[model samples]
Target: MITKQSVIGFIGTGVMGKSMARNLQKEGFPLHVYTRTKEKAAELIEHGAVWKNSVQELAASSDVIITMVGYPQDVEEVYFGEAGILENAKEHTYVIDMTTSKPSLAVDIYRKAKEKNIFALDAPVSGGDIGAKNGTLAIMVGGDEDVFQRMMPIFEVLGENIRLQGGAGSGQHTKLANQITIASNMIGVCEAIVYAKKAGLNPEKVLESISTGAAGSFSLSKLGPRMLKGDFAPGFYVKHFIKDMTIALESAKEMGLSTPGLELSLRLYKELAEKGEADSGTQALIKLFE
Candidate 1:
């Protein structure tokens, strides 16, 4: 059972991970941190998070390890090698991969973790940096019921909407579904604002009206203003969103599902990335229209 006394080790202190870790620390969980770039973790270190030099060291010392790295490759790198979490963490330690990664990878991690008697969960999140900072992310978890219950205290510190989706890779599958929805919705959000501006309508006032109507969406209400103001700072990066869309596209293909909108969005984002806005926030998609 995880308690406040359980030592939490966090990996990947980028835009979202840093905030998530800070919230955990604020809730008084003893925190140990590791990241490829030590500089990104400076704030947490100053706030009393013990910094580990590598994944092995952090895994060896932590009772619960939460990873919010960038990609599936990074997830595998941190969890599968000689210096990885599975090899270094003590048996029965709860390991949660919060990275938005492959469902297959999540299942593989669960199986390998079971072989070593380590508990594993794929708990990806939504609401981006804002949610991470505010501790209101929608956490979609894939793991055993008992384990989810045991980790509730920890999850509560990081998010308000939390649910056990199913076994093994379900959390990742759910996150893919979320990304698919966002992929298409973003295009529409960008188009609406562009149209409003071109038609001489005040986009802000238009948003104020439509944001609460059938046209309402998180992207519209939140990222819409960001688009209007040309504030493209990444609440979620265009590059990462591209990675997610590619993954979702692959997964959809494997399932014999067709995602026309997802495909169109992916094509547009790749064009945006090629034009050198990959590092920009996803709201920058509006620039394609501009």
Candidate 2:
């Protein structure tokens, strides 16, 4: 049972982070939030979250600091910058990063946190904006089992499924595996939607049939209708998805693994982003085919 005394410091109020923080707050944890823009902090504040001005301020005050920032650079700034969390983090703090960043960066941050006797985890998450909003995200966490278990109740408020996959950087690795599947799945859903539209079948009916079968995917069931409607509002931004795919491909290259399909998917997403689709939802990949 997490109390109001547990100051939930969430350092990234972007689409998914905001929803995750809002859900945590709704479940009764007092929140301390920081984002680059004050305007971006607006929604969280209205939902019973207290806004903090800087990452260090959030770190110094909070019992548990959770970061959901974007990219490797964003993670660095939040945890290791001049006024970063690491520089100011107090003892008995459990620092959890929910960012989908490079595994190497996660390892670097974890070592630094350990030197300070702070318990930190690389706990990246999946299930997109909808999942974050609904508190049903599938979380992949990597930390000491004791720290992971201690944080379990808090994670329960933010995600439907949580697993402590392994140590150090395992969460990010699991997230890469997750992105590999999501990339392939998005392509399948995109092609299916395009094919159904041209074949004179109501894509919705086709969606119903495929969804209950083994052919089903989250993309097909949740985002297919929106793709058919041509609405590109973000459920998961194409930019973020492309970043995850690129990270997975880089990891594959380092380990000498073959993933031609992921390479192809990465290229397609880059083309979509270059054509100005970065901010749109991943479902907008269907527009690339159209």
Candidate 3:
């Protein structure tokens, strides 16, 4: 029963979270925000989001809490720490985690939340920075179906294509599958550009020829131009991409599935990370070829 009157608490105001939180504000929900760095949330604060000094305070006051933090460890800390969400959220409050994290952790949070009569959802999203700013992300959710339905209005505000994949942790599993595709796709995008360059064809012209054809993909169409212009800035960070691939690799191993392509992509990303490109975007994989 999320309404315009529901007090929304948002934690994590980084590259994507800031825009996502802004959209919620635009929809007229009163937003309470908490981030590790208060300055990171200055714009939202200026736009009428009240900044809470602690997670416990935000959880206690908010009707619906959304988190888009970094790393599985960070997720664990925010939800399970001494002053964490589960410890402080009011009964019947809805807690949604939008971070790309392990499915097991999502299930764990769901179980813990249910014991306290709270509604918990793992609703990881795709589409990176551009998607966040444009409100065109694809949100994959896992939780009780009724709870998913309850959060549709909020989801609609933040994403274009939203789906309830299944029960607890399903959203994270689906996100892992999405990351698997992107892992291979990013490599292909990098190789295509590198191949075009080596063959003395103008890579931009080559992109024009193939981008609309079967070879076209999100990475090629969106991140390819950035590659051509040597804009290795992060639409999504290499460290985060590596974290995702590592999770996918571990998840695949658990399911007794083979993921050779994902493995190779992980290796390449690890190489780039080792070379101190960890803060760069995934498209910076082209640096490997250079």
At residue 65, give the lDDT of candidate 1. Answer: 98
- Tell me the number of clashing residue pairs for each predicted model: 0, 0, 0
- Model 2 scores worst on lDDT over the 10 consecutive residues at 1-10
- Return the candidate ranking by TM-score, descending: 1, 3, 2
lDDT of each: 0.96, 0.88, 0.95
Q: Where is model 3 more than 4 Å wrong at Cα?
A: none
Q: Candidate 2 local accuracy as lDDT? A: 0.88
Q: For candidate 1, lDDT tens digit of each residue in 1-290? A: 77788999999999999999999999999999999999999999999999999999999999999999998999999999899999999999999999999999999999999999999999999998999999999999998999899899999989999999999999999999999999999999999988998999999999999999998999999999998888999999999999999999999999999999999999999999999999999999988898
Q: Which stretches of candidate 2 lie over 4 Å from their true place?
A: none
RMSD (CA, Å), candidate 3 to true, equals 0.8
**Residue 167 error for model 2, in Å?**
0.3
Lowest-lDDT window of 10 residues in candidate 1? 1-10
Task: Tell me, by TM-score, which candidate is best.
Answer: 1
> In candidate 2, residue 29 scores what lDDT?
84
